[model samples]
Target: MSSERGETVAPDWPHPSLGNDLTPRVAAALAAAIDVPDFGTDVDATLAWAVATGADVATAPLAEAWQLLASTAFVDVGAARIIEPHLDALRILAEAQRDGVAADLSSLGADESSMWGVFAAEGSGMRLTARTSPGGWTISGTKPWCSLATSLTHALVTAWIDDDTRGLFAISLRGPDVVCHEGPWHARGLSQVVSAPIDLDGTRAVPVGGPGWYLSRRGFAEGGVSVAAAWWGAACALLVPLRHAARTERADQIALLHLGEVDAAMWSARASLMAAAEEFSHDGGDTLVASRVRTIVAHAAEQALRSSDHALGPAPLVGDAAHARRVADLGLYLRQHHGERDTARIGRDLVRGPASW
Candidate 1:
């Protein structure tokens, strides 16, 4: 990675933190663990290391947490994919606790070994609803995009509280009433992280927040930005082979040109992430800023992918497992940005009112 002064830095270089004391230690731990031979393949080991880091987004500086996430993604996109959701779930619960929402880890089936996920995607003609019963709250219906639902111990699901209102609930996926359906998930990227629909038959749930609270919270935007950080990290990882190709075997002007383009895109994206982290640390979450960061990073990631393909060709994709996985995982992950639809929405928002630059 290139600094603002045009000097090179290691991929695991620690970004400046907002007075967070744990930042350096966290960076060192991640840098040390990421080089392990088995860390990428063992999700449990990665998760355990992540949990041990004790980096809480709610308590620590948001930049610190985002940097941690980005560093994890830089080494292993699959590991980052697994770690991100679990951390997000913890943040959601923390927010719930801070808001005086009635929730307890034990009631949510969270334990020392519990793996958490968030399931909020709604499908057409399929509705998941939470209804009040004498026995407490129960959720029934099919929830789409429940990643790792079969293997996860618990999840935070968003379901319709009423006709037009949605609320967040924590439920145990291990219950007899909860069923993880087979098939439907066939993606090459992040192949280990299976995302499929889950069927629930009156599964017991504990509400984390009130109706509309899940989407309305500031943390929601912050969470979106966190995904962008992961995207940025994967983009950075793609440059590793590019840099190697540039160093080991010099090439013509065309390869150098593509390398420069990739570098410019990734450098700008990294700068954007750091700037966004500073803003989030102070001003909290602004939907517009978060959207802009995600959109900008998404564009940069796409550019990096394109330029890398043009420069290195098919050797890295076929010869290297980590490089190939990062390429595919990043391509798939960037789709969460919603492309032109989100871009148009941002443009319309800018046109409608006052903007923050």
Candidate 2:
């Protein structure tokens, strides 16, 4: 819970959208309803509240509310809470599939849910496995980065077991053998994400499907779309404030024009991502389309962030405004889990055939 330098930064004003009074009240209500443990901070509590609330609300309303509350404080709270529930659901679905039980996953609102799974690296860092046992199997390895590790309840960890290499396991968060260490994540932006190293110390875990669970055609395709959605959400966080700053602040015509272009590109990127997500849900997941969506969204996000910085000038760097923190957070969050490299791979896959490594 302390910064790397042990420097105590001053407490920032509560996010404007959350309001001084209302945000706390909502957070309190959310804490009371959810079963979050005592280990997390206030931001963690708040994120749980926002996601739980947003998940049940209508899509437009949820997005509107998220826009209002999209601050470092709110995002920290929301991302922690949002990731776990979806991860738990995914575990159940994957387990059901493994056990030969058919499931109707459409009702879970696939488009809105976040993917909270973990994939391991072989030998040095990138190997997959799944060892079997009579009672239950055990998974041991390290995942490069788990974005919501601090708050995630379960993770789909990939590993190599026995002769099979590409294996998957649904590991519970509350298990004894699992050790989640907060890794060194010192970046200029997205300071709150806590995308750290997680050590699974021979943890007892339930197997999900079989070998090729993660890299298989279906899983890879769906995963691409899910990652695209997350990137799109981050893009919107930047766009909303850029639009406000452009309309209200005294900026040049060129700045306004650049803002317009960024907005258009972001919207187009979102549409493409959503279309791919819908396709995955409808056509049982398509890797080609998913890779294309991921590539487009990554480019769009980079463009949007750069344009926002250009339009807002030094405003984002000076004040402790929610917009400023969001920009910083997005910059860091986008880099998590081989973000740029993954984006490049997606592009390469689009040009070539199916994706590999």
Candidate 3:
């Protein structure tokens, strides 16, 4: 999509990973595959690509996470968002491997498989009830916003075992009686992710952790920033077109100004991520810092969306399939951050005291 009189096209401006300890094979592969539209790939095939390319990152060394950030940024964000949760599911499964988990999740790359972290969500919650049974446990009730609910082979789900207590279960979605209802998501963006509802009609599951363990884990909040990273990646994807137009579309001087602002915002977001990574590496965990990272990155993402749309105009969204989905996908994905509530929470944390700070 071109705006200037003679400029009939917008050149490709891909994300750059300079000396970031990022994966080489993954980066090259995603760059080549980016020509594909956001919703073009099926969920099962997407998972296969992610597993084959090491997109389902684990939280051991921070470098692996950064590599994931870079690669997903290079790929379609809708796919990135879907692949990341599966990675998180695998990470959790790895943690719960020794605790009587029957399924061999290590076969992620070997088969047509994908996992989901089916935890809490907005509006109607997953009232899933888990009960001790002859084989292991059975979950009843429904889980909401279950992304790839129908397509995924397995999921690390949250289920209530008692009135006030909830537990985590490693369940196979292919099991009998599990019905994945048609998607409740009608959003213009991330429709490819297909967040739907699933009813576990006495589906058997392998127990992972007890009540409160999910949120209480050391990586609970830290893992959240990874979502923010993906958000930042999508936002940065918007920049490539903006940067291209600013450099090529010389008639529009204001476009350069927009690029400048977005560059600064992206810089700040990246710095915050690196700083959070360093903090997590050194201090083990910092929920407060991670929350701040989410707020800052989300704010930058929102700003990038607005600024890029304003600067580059709607031609990209209207004409370019990849650009349109990137914009929409990012717009929807950034909603994971709680907006003003996050900023207020950060402020409250700062105002509270330095004792915990």
Candidate 4:
């Protein structure tokens, strides 16, 4: 993709400064770590580093958002993804404490740094079920798309309370009743994430929020936007090869055109996310804004992937380590975002018009 190192030098656009206290150093550290090509291979050590520097467990849920951004930019989505729900669980725990739900949160963040994946998808199929008696609650069933299921210390899962309702629960992943089925996953990209369907046989569980309330939690939309930020990071990262390719004459004129277009898409995605961030601060957990930004960024990511693939052809896809990983990683991660369905959902929400918040 490059013209022999110094054939023509590109004026690389700086990765986002984010202009937040946590992001500057965290981004720098992440940028440095990306150079290693396999920095997140050790999930625990990487998490420890993230916690030591950027993640403040005490002020969490959203406090670590910027750090998540930094890590995502560096293609550490698997690690960052695992940490996301743990922080959310802590936030939910805080809410539970305020609501007088009597459960112990003392076990968290004490023994070891935890990587938690949230298993909250309520889609039909082999769904998880919860049963309660005088003894306590027990959960049993399957959860799909469980990222880092085997590696994470814990999970916040969603299960059926009845035919019409669902509830969120916090549970340890290592329990004897829990079975993490690793064989079913066959993803080429983000295989590092280790997503698998979990089968639980009466695993003891602690409810995180009341039935039907998990999706309405304050951080639900915000956490989604945070994930959008991560996907946007991978989207932004896909451009380095394109940028470098654009700098030289040997790079085909057609290739240069593709790079320019992809750059625009990246910029547009960033701009939309910045708008959503503003909305988040003012309105608080605006699902409308979250969906809007996620769709816009995912659109950009789709365009970038297509343009880059057409522009660069096959060499970088297989030969360039960083470029290859970024393409595959961003491609797969962005799938976590639903394109037209989300766009329509937002459109449906707009029946009252933009005049109403």
Pick out the ten consecutive residues of candidate 1 with the lowest summed lDDT: 1-10
Q: Report the lDDT tens digits of candidate 1 across residue range 239-308.
A: 6666666765567777778778887887888788888888876777788888898999999999989988
**Candidate achieving the largest TM-score:** 1
- For residue 239, give model 4's deviation from the true position in Å: 2.1
Model 3: per-residue Cα lDDT over 1-357, one tens digit each:
113201312245445442364465555546544443322245665666555554334534664565475456545676677767766766655555434443544433224344565555524655788899667678899888788777677777777778877777777777668898776679888776788888889887766666667666666666688788788777777777777777783637688888988989988988888887877777766788888889888988898999978987878778777777777778888877878987888778877867354
Candidate 1 Cα errors over 4 Å, as ranges: 1-22, 28-37, 54-58
Candidate 1 local lDDT, residue 20: 47
lDDT of 4 at 223: 69
Q: What C-alpha lDDT does candidate 1 achieve relative to the native structure? A: 0.77
RMSD of 1: 4.5
Instruction: State model 3's lDDT.
Output: 0.68
**Per-candidate total of colliding backbone pairs:** 0, 16, 0, 0
Q: All candidates' TM-scores?
A: 0.89, 0.68, 0.84, 0.84
Q: Each candidate: what lDDT?
A: 0.77, 0.52, 0.68, 0.67
Compared to the true structure, candidate 3 yields what TM-score? 0.84
When summed lDDT is taken over every stretch of 10 residues in candidate 2, the lowest stretch is: 1-10
Q: Report the error of model 3 at residue 237, Å.
A: 1.4
Ten residues in sequence with the least summed lDDT for candidate 3: 1-10
Cα error of candidate 1 at position 22, Å: 8.5
lDDT of 4 by residue, 240-280 (tens): 67777777778877878888898788778777776666666
Among residues 3 or more apart in sequence or in different chains, the pairs in candidate 4 whose N, CA or C atoms overlap within 3 Å are none
Over 4 Å off, model 4? 1-13, 19-37, 47-67, 75-79, 86-103, 107-112, 352-357
